[model samples]
Target: MPRPQKVRKILCPPAMSGFSPYGIPATDSEPIIMTFEEFESIKLVNYEKMPQEEAALLMQISRPTFTRIYNRALNIIGIAFVEARSIQIEGGNCEFEREWFRCTRCFKLIEGLENHSKCTDCPHFEKNELTRLNPDIKDRIA
Candidate 1:
């Protein structure tokens, strides 16, 4: 009779216009595995100038949860910069509720839940995940 827990969506940095991807240097120090959802919380509230309440509502989380996520994200950013460490985004308890489509061939489940016209294991299926409905964003999180 218990309600199912809600899955938080990863909030990405506001669509940056003309921004290029840059890789941070990795170090011997352990990399922090901040989830995409937490990262989005910081970007929305801090960078996008959204109020905590508004951001929380948008994220479908309580205000306190949003605040905690935002703070954790900020801390990760600060540590990465101050320590000159590479930051790897990974390992969150969240689940993807998006329409997940199973590959008819390989039985691979696509996170976006959409069929990309081919199985992920197929040789010709590589157009880079973003273009495909089921992107492996988490696997490539670096």
Candidate 2:
């Protein structure tokens, strides 16, 4: 049997769940699903200007694996851009360094529950308004 996939370590979840082309209703086409690890690869290598080897070390993966993930992310993004399709960011064999939450009202990412109260600046800030980005992995594994 093949070796089990390693769980990638991600700093945090993406600020937004997904993206869509302007003027086009997302219902026009099926959304492309991009895993969290793929998003992290793009963020580290492209957005942060991090080298592939360095990013691999940061994510605790081999350079070749990191390159594959980065290339896949680029290709998915390219297809989404060219085809006017929506891109959804979710689902990966990864664990976040810390718990993350997002305020649905203002769409602000809150790093931790302790800081949730600080999101009072959001017009509709409420305890219930916070959605946990990193649910317990055990629940998902089963």
Candidate 3:
């Protein structure tokens, strides 16, 4: 049996879901769907100027896997531009790397979205202080 896919972690999702080419009529053909992970790979490797190795580590995926994702993203983007087709960024096995805090009282981890100020199971549920979690890939481009 094939190995299960690892859930990629993205810091934040793209603001826009897709882009349509200007001066082109909407076509019946389906838009090229770019997975969130693919988008992330492009952003990290291209925009963020992160090395493939560190980007892969930040994504919690292997270097080769990250390379494949990056290549696929570039290919799809090129096709979208050449064909003047829309590009939709969505649909991937991913999870947002949201801030998590461990409760001091119960030692239970809580997500940032939940109302964690007051906990019934514990005496108090102060939210965990925010800290930089993602690897610093600024100069580690090896």
Tell me the whole-model lDDT of each prediction, alpha carbons only.
0.57, 0.85, 0.72
Model 1 ranges with Cα > 4 A deviation: 1-6, 10-28, 95-111, 117-123, 126-142
Compared to the true structure, candidate 1 yields what TM-score? 0.56
Q: How should the candidates be ordered by TM-score, best one leading?
A: 2, 3, 1
Location of the lowest summed lDDT over 10 successive residues in candidate 2 = 133-142
Q: Write the per-residue lDDT of candidate 2 for residues 66-97, one digit (tens) a residue.
A: 88888999999999999999999987878888
Models 1 onward score TM values of 0.56, 0.86, 0.67
RMSD of model 3, in Å?
A: 11.5
Give one clash count per candidate, in the order shown.
Answer: 4, 0, 0
Query: Which ten-residue region of model 1 has the weakest summed lDDT?
Result: 12-21
Candidate 2, lDDT over the whole model: 0.85
- Candidate 3, residue 109: the lDDT equals 44
What is the lDDT for 40 in model 1?
Answer: 72
